[model samples]
Target: MFVGIIVDIISAINMFTGQVIPARRWMEPFLLHNQSILGSVFYVITYGGRCIQGATATILSFCRVCAVCFPIFYQKLGQPKYIYTMQVLQLFGGGVALVLLWKDEYEYILEDNGLYSVGSDETNADWFYMFVAIMEVFFVVVIVLNNLVTYTMFRLKFNKKNAMKNNGVSPISSQTNQEKQKRESGLDKMTFIVCLVELIYFAYIVYSLQINPYMNKRIFYFFYNILCVIYSTFSAWMLLIVSKPINTELKRMFLIIGGKRLTRSISISVQGSRDNHK
Candidate 1:
């Protein structure tokens, strides 16, 4: 997630600087024009980072599904070192893409009706996009499978947990177990949303890029926002929403502050009333 966020940030910079700012011509200090150093860098980060994020997201969804369907094996394979190694390999894959495109010419090439696109020259462009598209589609497929597995496991566990409760198990154990199950269910639901959103967003992105490769600059920039910043923003908020611990902590903090202010107000009111009475 952290890596995704960083990639999104760089992509946003590329989008606005390379495309949006130039289109609007609003206080344009610099332009990421064709065959420029900055343009090359933007292409590298935008494409390469996309590959990185796509691959990692698929891995993440797989991990979650594994946790649900094969908890024992998931635990065995879920060590920090192992996960880190996998992440590094994913980065390496992206790095390869980056290296390939590092020297490739980037251009705000002209589109139909005098519009410009934030992309590379014809050379290596076709296969590069195909590579990114493949990873994105692979991620969608994997996440869909993961979603099915997670939903099945969640439903089964939910039914079993409810049955135990209805059977009048020990009150304390039942409550404790129920709470645990609730947390698990919440996580599963979160995973469901994550997978569903991934399916939707990636499908939209891929479809849009394919069907309409040439468009007005503003429209393209809007799509860029959807591709990176907006998606990341949604993920962040959804994470906060699904995180019980974070929600609880935030609620506690708010309560503490509210209580203090209420108590102080009451004390002030009481003192004023007494003074008026006396």
Candidate 2:
């Protein structure tokens, strides 16, 4: 869930920074072409938003682990409306800050100094990249927590099953060997796939952080942001694929796409059968 929220926040910020920031020319009509104020306002919004969202992801990740490990306690706490509300407030507050900064028309001005370099302080992209780096910290932390929990769950489950079998008191002893194997195999496969996608996301974050410092070169920055876009969208796509409702929708889509010739995947069918049996 932490990763999911991070995915959403980063994607939104990336969209604004990539499309809205560099396209200041198009925004001039909206803000009367006040370039300094525009840059200041957008920079604040982009970076501030990233910071708030990153913090939120860290909190959410901790909450998710607690909930999963202590289901009863989590249930007793009731709904998570307050958490959602806080996220909404973060976004609103960031937006309001941008508006106030823009209204004040704040911008750093240098006196007629000795000289100005090609990439002057006014042209510094580090502010933007600094926020990106901060956001990536959340990504790394959450990824670490997620991988740890997932591996722990797998280890415990595997060990318990093995111990039970060795003691000749297996939980699934009543079931046919083939059925037990199928169920176990499905669980392992699903968990493996989820972990693999997570590793991909972590790799993308690392790649972005490594390249962020060199964003001034047009070709390098262009390709970097392009990768960011792809990673953002693809991560969402992978999560949606695993989401129960979304998976249902995807299967339905495939059925339609295949025009009645496509059968449901074996795992899905088997899971459905177990659900019906229960």
Candidate 3:
């Protein structure tokens, strides 16, 4: 997640430089000469970031599955070493995939209108298109399957709880059941949100695929770049929203800031009163 954020930030800067700063005469030469390098950077960051995000989604799905289907083993899965190893492996795989899929020979050229554009070889472009299409399908399928499994687990748990209530389970057991239900409810909501975002992202990928590559409109390119940044950030934003601990910490931070401001205001008012008396 941290890597994805950093990559997205770099992608944003690259987009800004390419789209907004190219008009400046002083920057044109430097920009033109470095366009290919920037293009490669953009390519790696954009696609690599997507791969990272997809891995994150996959990991989350796996954790959700473990929590639901194998709760006993879930505690073992939470070990720091296990998680770190998984992340390291995922990143290594993503990096390798990016290198294999990226077109290193592509060049960026200066347009007559003083803009820099990345030019891809036709063969490489087609390969990238196919790669993205396959990845889109794979991600969509995985997320849908995860959602299905999660929903099934939720239903089973719900029915079991109802059955226990009807059977007049002990008050202690009932209280425990309620607490479990609350936790499961939150988890269900979070999983739903994650699935929803993944579906939206899948649609965006399809849209990009269907659109003709020959259009070459600046607006289209700009919006596409914006979408890429959004794609990288959306999952993290949703995670933060659905995470209780993060939300609580955020509220606490805001309250602290607000308290400081309030104290400053009171001090200023007191000082004004003192001046008036003087």
Residues 38-121, model 2: lDDT tens digits? 556444544455445444444544455565476776675445885666466446535543544434333322223211111235
Residue 94 deviation, candidate 1, in Å? 2.8
What C-alpha lDDT values do all the predictions have? 0.69, 0.50, 0.68
* Per-residue lDDT of candidate 1, residues 1-278 (tens digit): 67767766666677666555546654333443333665667667766766776666777777777787888978876688877877785686568677677767655544442334344555477667677777778878877887778778878877897788788888898888877776776777677776766776677667656666545656655666665765556556766787787789889999999999999999999999999999
Provide the TM-score for each candidate, comma-separated: 0.78, 0.51, 0.75
Error of 3 at 110 (Å): 7.1
- Residue 264's lDDT within candidate 3 is 100
Poorly placed runs, candidate 3 (over 4 Å): 1-26, 97-103, 106-116, 169-187, 206-223, 260-278
Ranking the candidates on TM-score from highest down gives 1, 3, 2
lDDT at 273 for candidate 3? 100
Which numbered prediction scores highest in lDDT against the true structure? 1
| Pairs in clash, predicted candidate 3 | none
- Kindly provide the TM-score of model 3 when superposed on the true structure, using C-alpha atoms: 0.75
Winner on lDDT (1 vs 2): 1
**What's the true lDDT of residue 174 in model 3?**
87
